[model samples]
Target: MSVTAAKGFTAAGIVAGIKENGNPDLALVVNTGPRRAAAGVFTSNRVKAAPVLWSEQVLKSGRLSAVILNSGGANACTGPKGFQDTHATAEKVADVLGVGAGEVAVCSTGLIGVLLPMDKLLPGVETAVGQLSEHGGEKAAIAIKTTDTVHKTSVVTKDGWTVGGMAKGAGMLAPGLATMLVVLTTDADLDSDALDKALRAATKVTFDRVDSDGCMSTNDTVLLLASGASEVTPEYAEFAEAVRAVCDDLGQQLIRDAEGASKDIKVEVINAATEDDAVEVGRSIARNNLLKCAIHGEDPNWGRVLSAIGTTSAAFEPDRLNVAINGVWVCKNGGVGEDRDKVDMRYREVHIVADLAAGSETATIWTNDLTADYVHENSAYSS
Candidate 1:
């Protein structure tokens, strides 16, 4: 289960005739709640999709009653007509669900610079509304896939409340929220302020650190909605932890299912001058294409790691820098340490630890090895 794992939520997915391939392409999630509080995070990119722009305004109210999502077309770069289409879709959903148009959030993903078929999508919204069920979470997740081989969902239940969500992304994964559409729902009785704080905190360390291909999508959006059906307000720390766990799990799933990826790389930067420095160093290492290619070839290339770190503005001494690959110290004192061959690379998960030796701060960034299949898939993506 995904969003519907939480109480007071009903969801559905159905074929919307938007994708020429006849794949499921429309999803709807509604909050039948006594209280509706919501928060959201979107891509930092200046060029945002129409849905993102519309949803940003909707979230300003810090309340939501439903979310409508679709795949097969991003509805981006299509100008005023695209935004009109998005607003019209939301109106259709509101008309069917008998909710305020301002209370509806929309999300779209897939190829950019294309217009969605409103003829098919609007009717699909009605169909999805009719099929809404408590168990439609998985189907909704499947309807949002582009090139993903599998759908992703995560759930965390506390003593009396739960936080659950679904995500879709297999390519164009990078920072600025990892090029994905994620909707998280909870039954805990929390206000918009609490939900906003926890969501920002959770996403800062989770989605903000995943860099698969160093490409961000314009449609990236992550939403958290509260229904207050449980009427159980746990401690802020506990709720925040549950939210972080779910986001972390979903972030890892995105890396595991990265397009054409073979090895999941964990780049840990330790002993940095500050947390910002640590994060900068970790992202630098994770986004280095040379390091990614080398990882795919099972090579413990510490030099590539050092080179990537040197490109960052972080505080570090080349002579004091140390690097470890899969628990084997491959570089120490900025020179070769143990034999590189001793570092085993037989597993699908590779760990790279970089010690800045400047302070006591640390950060980890998740990424995946680059592969030829990635090029082939992306080259023919629009064809």
Candidate 2:
């Protein structure tokens, strides 16, 4: 289940000499399409990466014929030269694929404030183009890794068409789209407007709700390209649901593979005055380092959860709040309800439910427990 799983796409991943360790660091994904309608969502970060800036411009036309990705350097904060390198790379891909430079999108990941070796990247693009294949999606997915231990891909097939995608992220995972570079492809007949509507709606609850390290990246990007290869236009609602399912699956995969995380925590906030209130409360709870540490130690410290909730401006009465850990009501009516020891935390998955008791709206945020491994990994990441 990958980008090439959809019709009208070819992909390749190859070693580009960008990574000193000699892993595959370059990827090319091309839409051999009858229609190149596209939509994109990028990092809201003010300090955007060079590739992100370039891709944003390319996406303004709502068309993309190809995407080139690299995983050894973020190409961010390197000033005009960095952007020049990104442009040169896109131009190379376009040259090889016989498409306009503006029809190419670029994505890069890895350390920030460094320039990519254009000498290697431009040549790598030519090599990647030579190897493009329908079976290359898996390789392309594997090529876009930074700290990720495993590559992630998801696919959902409707009655007549399919939506497939690949995502790369393992750390710096937070709201504002998370530290991820995601490319989704669909053969369903849809215009850029429809794709944008479905992508934004799906990501709002999927990628936007994932808060692993409470940090955002300058290079986060998600793009959806439609080829209209299947020549099938399902109902808008049905198409949107398929996109949501794939994005949700990929989001869960990111949480599961979060750096140094032993427990995947799902924070669900319910009965809020509005959806915004619910999301705010859930993010507050998920981003609470104290609660994450407690979860790491298998301690069902509901107080941390309550304190996190209290910090939010959401509509909730202190006396009417309720909290549950692993299906045990640890806090009911804002007071201790059940034995904390009754909460089980032996498994890798932990569920926390926060009831605001203000309305019927609800939201869920996915995160992971903080641990020593995470600290160690990130502390020495630059090395």
Candidate 3:
């Protein structure tokens, strides 16, 4: 259940004075042996965090030995100074670990437009490096949380290899890889090219499919490190599959813990003319506040679902559409099928299946129900 007990890497977390509450806000994960090949994905937001910019450059070499992450101060919108802070943080870690700065990726989350507390962060990095251990994954997970109630981590073992990951995010979560931070480590002997390929594929299906608040974060990054410490190389197919399972698990946890969420909604769009169309349909519906609010209110408003899909370019004739909620047919051929009152919404999980009646392509996206709490939590978040 602990992050370190999962496998592949050693981690440590310490209070870095980044948060006013003095919670542990700095974390480090080191691939202790056999240097690992690395691959990373970052936010598509044109405005990126300083750590994201730094890590994006480091990942180009396809080699990584460690990662340093902090919460409570997202080093974004601080201009050149933010970049300097990220570089300094990585350099401090590299100096202690005896590795090049490029071998360490940096990530940060929390309030944007502010500077990081470098005075405390630099020393905190030293303490984290000293506490590294295989069982320190949970602590590292804990250290990176902003509004999360609990740390999110997942481990999957396949034959001779193990893949594990830690994630943190409770708000500002949407597609293009949620406004979250994720670090995945594996003992599989994979080259950087393969690692990159696998990570992209996995993210496309998992992280890229979740939209909780529709607001993207300034700091979002997913880094994959392979230690090859196990000395057991599996087929690339097998390794990628294992990595995907871990990502899927973490993605689900992110949605379940979404800020102010009362229910986790899974939106499935089927029969689209193409995969892109399927995803477009799914995302439009996932990001619709009206539909989300309807679901939260236990209102089987199939009309809202249709209206959301109509806003997309999924090539579906309005009259040919069909909708179902929690396995109960609510609409058929764009008209009401069963009594809306027959559906139950008391459960924590909700499913919406939309049939485009086009081609065979399909996609699924995970989102959360909208509630008054969501508005309250975000409206005054920065205050």
Candidate 4:
């Protein structure tokens, strides 16, 4: 059901003519709630989008009644006018929902540096609001797609409570805070503090581990809202686990649907002295373009892995390092160890293991192979 799968929430998606192609480009998600508790994370890029700046301020109140998102324009680098557009959008949502403008959060995604068609969007807001329905979650998810080929949604249920989420990203998929726009809703009895705690814990290992193209978006946003309609107060740990499960699933889906990617690579860093060390090593391997090209070519290249690790500050002994590809140990003690000819590379998924031999901590990062399709898709992206 996506965001509207949770109790006390309704959503709708409509064609706003913001996209010249006439696709449904605007989505509205509302909290018909007994409680309006929420938390969010945005892109760490210094060049933030106008909508992100507005939503970041709205979320400081630690409550949100509704969120409006559009996929036809990024509204970044458009100066003060862009922020005004976002502000006006929130005011429009507030007017219709009978709430203060401060209670509404807004998100926009698409080509950067372009102004949105407010003549089309402002009126579309009223139309989308009239069509709000709990079953409209899937439509909202579909409306967020840009270069993505598929819509992403995930749901997990527990006793008397459930968490549902929707995400969209096909490029600029890197980790800082979030790589794309994601909306998560839960029916549990949670306050803003509880949600902030749960969301930070979830995105740490999930969204933060995905590094598809190593490019961070200026408008990335991940928001979690709670309606408290289930009337069930779940344990903090249990609720956090459920949130993590949904984020993890959505992150994996983003990687699988990454733009022009032929192989999905999973890099596992083991035997690290600390979790941070493991994560750094894994992220380094995941972002290595040379290693990604090797995986796409079905070539077992242990040298590239060592080169990536050497650039990181993670704890490791050069001579004691080990590397494995698809269950075949290709390098041992920082040199050639296993037969590269025995490694399998026919599958779309490739697994690479890096052993630091420093301790027992571990972490994994997901990435996709670079290809000609990726270059072409981005080169002609704005046309």
Candidate 5:
């Protein structure tokens, strides 16, 4: 479906002079309200970007009229100037929209330690405001990307409500939201409490489970805004489910498009003592570069998976572990299975299953295969 038909929100993207590439670097999303509640989740990294800190504070009100974002400068570790830049950006957007500064949230991504060029950014916000349209979702998605090859977006409809989202991330991705930037828009009527609860739960399973390169970022942010534009207030349960599905799709896409990545890997942990245990075990495997590299090489290395899981606190007997790759049983009773050669790593997708043999719980994590290209790309990233 078209992003306009799906999101029912207005957006704009413009080149704000933040990037040297001259590509679009500033974006704006506004809900032409019937004002709806909003929810946000920022990076878990203690060293957060200035925008992240500002948005987190504003999100407490559960009311958002607009979001302003920029790329090419993270505005992290820039000290007081960073906060001032964020404040100035939001104030500008609020002034343009005739709303309070606190009513607008801000986000930024790109190079770290560099100050935001207010001279370039201030005027860019004005240009973005002029370009707002329902068709701007795709442009906004592309504007947020740093090393990503493509923009990620997803939409789903259920009952009478719609949930739509755009995401961007390529490197410095790991759990606790994956060094990603996301904006979710919905027309369902929901309160701040319900939106916050739903966003947190959905993120725990989706964005929180993806681990690409295992490095977190200072600029990750996921903002969800409900415009109540649909005027359809479905049950909270149904609305949350639709939101989860959108996040799940976007999270998988982020893994698929990770920088220098050739394969998207799925790690599943089953029969853990509890859901938390299952998630922990799955995440451990997802974050292991050695295991990811082994999978990239098409080596059904059950030992690597087992070793990674061992680092987790999940209660499991190593001797009872069972491993499978691409539906081919590669290990049984903690030993190598007979069909290890059947698993292929040459494809763009890879799957690994680990049976904890402890209980009836399961969790899955999405990741990217490690390659020498990944090393080369990151090694020279700043050069």
Candidate 6:
């Protein structure tokens, strides 16, 4: 259960020949709501997809009745015709769902700069809208996968309401926000202002901290829609916490399933002067290609960790720094502490802790180890 795990949402996934392999590539999520309030976050990338541009404008009214998503064409760098295709898509879904085109949000993923097969995609909306059901969340999640080995979904329930979401992204895993495409739904009685506040606060730490492959996508989009079907108005802090929990879970799943990764690495930076310092140091370590390769090889390379941290502008004295791999304090006071031979690196999950020895701020950035399979998959991805 994803979006449909919450109330007032119906979803469907279908194949409309958008992919040559005949796999599912189109999805529709409709909100049969008492409220149409919504909030969204898109890629900070300068180059964005046609759908991203379309959805950005549509969400200005803080209302979205449905979201139409497709995988197999990014519709980026295709200029005016690409935007026209995205517009035509929203219009089709709006007509079917009996909502204005401006009230529908659209998202797409796949190869960059390639135009979508509108002939297949436009007609596919009809099929998806027809099949929409409250039980269709899982199918909708599956239809949006690109390089992911499995579909991702998360849900959290409280007294009388629930928040649920689905995310799809394996390659281009790093993001100011990642989607490749994420849709979250909640039945709680919240307005657009509240939803926007919570969505930004939730993503700031969750999606923003995930850095697999260190590459952002052109089609990234995360949307939160409120149906107010549960009729429960949770305290703002409580509701925001619930949203954060789902985002954090989904972010971990993305790291676990990073394209062709052999290890899930968690880089935790501690005792920094500020939270921003901790995050900067942690992200630097997480995105270090050399460090990722070392992790993939199961080589407890503490030197790479220090080297990675040093490159960041975060507050840290070289001599006061400390490093640990797994549970072994391999480096202390900037020198070798425990015996390097005593560290074990056979586990699929590796944890690296860096103590900045500055103050009491900390952050964790989840990432993945680089492997030959990653190169292989990406090299042939557009084929």
Across residues 117-199, which tens digit of lDDT does each residue of candidate 1 receive? 99999999999999999999999999988777889999999999999999988534522222598999999999989999999
Angstrom error of the Cα, residue 257, model 3: value is: 0.2
Model 1, global lDDT: 0.92
lDDT, candidate 3, 1-383, per-residue tens:
33454356899988989899989999999987585789999988899989999999999999998899998888889999999999999999999999999999999988888899899999998899889988899899999988888899998978777888899995345322235999998888879999999999999999888778778788889999988887888898888898899889999999989888899999999899999999999999988989999989988899999999989877989999999999888999999898888899899999999999999999999999999888787776887
Model 6 lDDT vs. the true structure? Answer: 0.89
lDDT (C-alpha) at residue 233 in model 2 = 84
Which segments of model 2 are wrong by more than 4 Å?
Answer: 171-178
Say which candidate scores most in lDDT. Answer: 1
lDDT of 1 at 62: 96
lDDT of 4 by residue, 298-333 (tens): 888899999999999998889999999999999999
Which regions of candidate 4 are displaced past 4 Å? Answer: 171-179
Instruction: Tally clashes: model 3.
Output: 0
TM-score of 5: 0.96
In order, candidate lDDTs are: 0.92, 0.91, 0.87, 0.90, 0.84, 0.89
lDDT of 2 by residue, 235-326 (tens): 99999999999999999988999988999999999999999999999999998999999999999999999999999899989999999999
Quote model 6's TM-score.
Answer: 0.97
Q: Name every residue pair that clashes in candidate 4.
A: none
Instruction: For candidate 5, write residues 1-383 as lDDT tens digits.
Output: 21333445888878888889898888888888786589999888999889999999999899998999887878889999889999999999999888899999998887778898999999888898899898888888878767777778898987777889888886345222235788999888888899899999999889988878778899889988988878888898888898899999989888888877888888888998999999889889988888888878878888999899889999998889999998987888888786777777778888899999999999998888888888877777656
Which pairs of residues have clashing backbones in candidate 1?
none
TM-score of each: 0.98, 0.98, 0.97, 0.98, 0.96, 0.97
Candidate 1 is scored at a TM of 0.98
